[model samples]
Target: MDPSGLPDFHGLPDSPVPSGAHDSPSLSALDRRIAGCRACPRLVDWREEVARTKRAAFADWTYWGRPVPGFGPPDARLLIIGLAPAAHGGNRTGRMFTGDRSGDVLYEALYDVGLASQPTSTHSGDGLELHGVRITSPVHCAPPANKPTPAERDTCRPWLIQELRLLRPTVRAALVLGAFGWQAALPAFAEAGWTVPRPRPAFAHGTRVTLPATDGGDDLHLFGCFHVSQRNTFTGKLTPAMLREVLRTAAEAAGAPTRK
Candidate 1:
């Protein structure tokens, strides 16, 4: 294991395994390892810095200050991939996409599709549950200015790669939230033994791709949706109705049986 306590995948070629990928059967155990990661010095420094110097609105709140982990059931069939945690969002709330405008938009959409137990994700233990979806990111920690260098992203690839390996059996499809997330996920899918398309699919507002199974398992479907960031939402680039339709499609594709 390296300084991040992760088995270094840096030595591998043609593989984008998350540095933290390992043989842990329980996602909870994997999450614990993710929380302890300090693989990227720049991100490690930046996330902790924001935690200590919190915004005025959350001045009294204690921040998680560690790598945020994927949230939802272990046997989830639908996976939602997004960019890294927000400095004051998941970095503060210890849950993916929690305590932020992004969650406000995402959870609301998930609820519309009957995938979320609640319409709001305020904190880690808020009693919110995702019916058949699991949420994760390519970068586990909050990056500086919300931008992770290519090297940082590669180093963190193993965590998500391993997550895919564990969930492949049940995960029928994945919803990639943005171009960054789309890029991050496709490579990891290839690394996790899925047969990616010859010419990689281009990303768009509603792009869809099908990845065949190499291990004789079920094929995996991929969908694209504009990120639910404030920049997009506040500007009307991605509205509630738009997001709801995408989530409804993704959930149903994953066999969630969501009602229209």
Candidate 2:
């Protein structure tokens, strides 16, 4: 149990595996490992606390309280990057952006743009799937206060790097959901020798950047938008129409035939 009086996923040694283990695995194999991760003790403790408290209204819901993994078609060209897992949202549901207020606006916009098969994200078992998109987070684990330190973000980069390597699907564009996701991808881009321009690029509702590939090929495009956190959505920092337009632009750049 944790300070919040909730059960921690780390308590069980045989639960899920942490990222970067020598599993000789595919995306699904990585998914299983991430489902039982206990690497970050701090995150594990905080997530358990959120689960235990139940928050009154969510008392009956089963808490996932574990690491969250990216989910979508293996060949997806559009990669959607989110900030981090939410306490009651991704941490409780064991799936990114599910079972929380953040997902409400995200899924709705996804459906409106014809990227999602459904308009709601209830739980991991809700059979949600993205037709041409894949969703991942900067930090796979739920951070205390939903803010991951720079070190924590660095620690989590290997997993994202591996995922991108394995899912090399001629990426159309990336939808960075917040400042953290944008910052997290920077190191990866630098490692790949992609030249990013100055002014560092700011995080806004619809900012875009193009990076040259290492192979001297076409540049990869990145789009920035506010995270789908409850605070942003409820406060009107992002709107459904704005999100839909971003998706449309990404989809157009991603090319139509790649959807298959």
Candidate 3:
């Protein structure tokens, strides 16, 4: 771990870092570091440019324009993984899946299944909370055209790796939003001492993969769900009921109690 808060995790091992380790920062501290990262020049330029060029619909709003961190309680039992932040969505609101149509769909389903406190996530301090699940993306910074380059994705890997290490203690199940998220999570889990499948598990709706845990942790239950993007939602590929079912199943697998 880098004390200076650079993306350099050169000497850190793959296993979970002890909770109160002196040299390394905690999850909250790491999140601050993630927001301040300029390691990828391309990403920094793009996100800032988007912020500067205000969207017509959001001309009165101030954009956060930085890397968004995972949202939810630190002791969550489930993790929700997404691909990357949308330009005007997370880039504007500074919270993953917030102020976007995708978030509207996702949070609504999460609420329906008793995972999210509210049915919408409009801003950072909108009083919205996730019950037993935390949400994160493989790429923290919003990318151009909603697509992050291969180099950018690899450069951002260490952040996700570090986050997984911190969350490993309480995270017993994971709900991956799409193929990209599934692929991104596999390496992070493997690096965190979870035994991923040899050939890699194929991505499909409702797919489940149980990973045997190392480091004295419990086995991780993996669930696959289609992303809550408008492309899928409008086309009827991923419906509200479909997403709710998957989320509820993940919560059940993790033994998470429902508030609803």
Candidate 4:
């Protein structure tokens, strides 16, 4: 295990040279490369800095610090994309959508819909499992103020594209959480061989776009949802029922069964 005592799969503590994620032949390889990525200087600095100076609540915990990787099965049918990791969330737990309020809402919804084995994802080893869903983000590293610059988003696009390519055979639908993820994902889907529309549909809660595969493979149903951030959830902008409705619809679109 690394100095943090978490699994060694999260990659080295210090950022290495740029990881050529495009060359990854499998999802596992892509995840390792993503975790070791140091492509963006600003993100690299911010994530490491946050790791060193942890929040008061988690002062006794060892932070993951390095880039967080996607979590779930390689053959996931439903892919959920979000913005970058939360500095004290994924950046601390070493797994996407874990250890944060956003994750609390997301995992609970997934569990309610029978997509997840548990309703809570407190850490990497919490035994939570996604049935046929995979969670990832455009930016692997946490950024300052929970926002990654456009350039950083562009720089991280290749990893998402490669991941899409690897999951192309199985991923039939995607749930993009927020405008940032929606914008970032559209281009990556096109690059990964899915035929996105020319004008690119505008982002809106409950928006659905069907992207036909260039190779005549299965079509992808993309759904947009408000982010599960505290701002939305606390303010009732994204209620539990609303999130579950979107998740259930998207999961069904992917041909994955829902409990209700």
Candidate 5:
């Protein structure tokens, strides 16, 4: 164990076989790559600065200070898409929806709807598990002002596309957390050659849309909802029940079995 008593995987002895000899590419590996990425130098520098100076209120906390990566079961069919990482939230936790007020209500609703194993999201090592759901974002790296430009969003779409293609989920339903996520994903599908419907509607608390698959076969269903950010939850704009109902409807539309 390391000084913190956490398992020291980084200090393991070399194995007989090569590192990639018997391993298969997985979401965990993808996450690691994203964590080390410096694709956007501005974001890289800004995130690191926040990590170094703005420590959490809790003394024991250590900022993740890396690009937050997608997290959940590998074969999860439902996808929860958010706008971008928050400076003090995912940017500090190295995992989506951790270490922020936004996560408190989100995880609580997920736990209530059987998507997560725990309700409180304090840190990455909190033993939380997701069932049949994966949380991702339009932009993996946190922007300086929490708003990525259209070009930046475009630049990041390929990564998300790669993730979706690798997972090959049978029923893909996006829980778009805000207008930005919806805007980013729509053009992505179109560029993939999917003929999307016109007049993309504004995001609301619970709105759903269906689109033709960009692959020229199958269909992709998309759901829109207000982001469970501190702004929304703290202002009573999005209640836990409202979020839960949106998730339930999305799950049903995707044809996934309801949690017991």
Candidate 6:
């Protein structure tokens, strides 16, 4: 562990499999490997720089300073894919969708739909839980200006692909937030053994696509929803009710039980 008490990942390979982590076939191992990645030089510098020069609001906190891993169970039936971690949100808390307005909107909707145990995700050990869902992103590192370059996105694709391959056995549905996530997830799905359509589906709010599994498993139902960014939520683009409805539909498609 480093001075921050987190695992030390200095000099680790950017990709996990190439570093001999493939031998450990478990989500936990994959997560550790992901946390140790230093693949994109730009992302590495930005995330660490933010960690060192802490935000005023989070000045007392010890930033994660590493790639954020997917949250929820390994056997989750539903997967929610977002673009990437927020600079001060996941990058600080070390958990996806935590400590930000976007997370507030997301977890609230998940709680309303019976997928999340709590409506607030303040920290990693806040007892938050997802019943049958896993939340992840194509780019695990927090990028500058809330955007990653296309090359950086490609460099991060392997991690998502590996994650999909691990989750393929049980993941029955995916809800992608935003066009970036939709674009990133489709190719990863195809690489992970799903049969994407000849002409890839376009992304739009409430768009749904069904992908057949090549391994003869259950079909993967893909859904799209507007990202829970403040810009979208505050502008009346993606309201609470709208987000909840998409969550409910995706949860049901995954055969995941929901109270509402």
Q: What is the C-alpha RMSD of each candidate to the true structure, in Å?
A: 6.5, 4.9, 7.0, 2.2, 5.4, 3.1
Candidate 1 per-residue lDDT over residues 1-260, each given as its tens digit:
11112222232222223345256676776776777787787888899999899888888777878888899899999999999999989998888998899989999888888899889988776778889899999999999888999898888888888889889878999999999999888889998878899788989988888899888889898999999999999999999999989888888888975757
Off by over 4 Å in 2: 1-24, 192-199, 216-218, 256-260
RMSD (Cα, Å) of model 2: 4.9
Residue 189 C-alpha lDDT in model 3: 86
Worst 10 residues of 1 by lDDT: 1-10
Best to worst by lDDT, what's the order? 4, 6, 1, 3, 2, 5
What TM-score goes with each of the models? 0.91, 0.84, 0.89, 0.95, 0.84, 0.93
Comparing 4 with 5 on TM-score, the higher-scoring candidate is 4
lDDT of 5 by residue, 111-135 (tens): 8887889888766777888877889
Q: Of the candidates shown, which would achieve the greatest lDDT relative to the real structure?
A: 4
Q: lDDT by residue for model 3 over 1-260, one digit each (tens)? A: 21111122343322222222332357776766677667677888899999889788887777877787788888889989999988888888878898899999999988888888889888886788788889999898898888888787877778887887888888899999998888877988898779999899999999999999976679999999999999999999999989888888999998776654
* CA displacement after TM-score superposition, residue 41 of candidate 3 (Å): 1.3
Candidate 4 residue runs with Cα over 4 Å from true position: 1-5, 10-21
Whole-structure CA lDDT of model 6: 0.88
Ranking the candidates on TM-score from highest down gives: 4, 6, 1, 3, 2, 5
lDDT of 2 by residue, 26-131 (tens): 7776666566666666777887888778577677776777678887877777888898888878877777887677888888888877888789988766667787
User: If both were scored by lDDT, which would come out higher, candidate 3 or candidate 5?
Assistant: 3
- Candidate models: Cα lDDT each: 0.84, 0.73, 0.82, 0.89, 0.72, 0.88
Off by over 4 Å in 6: 1-24
Clashes of 6: 0
User: What tens digits encode model 4's per-residue C-alpha lDDT throughout 1-260?
Assistant: 33234536733444454443436878887777778778788888888999999998888889988888899999999999999999999999898988899999999999999999999988887788899999999989999999899999988888888889889999999999999999999999998888999799989999999999999899999999999999999999999999999999999999886899
Superior candidate under lDDT, 1 versus 5: 1
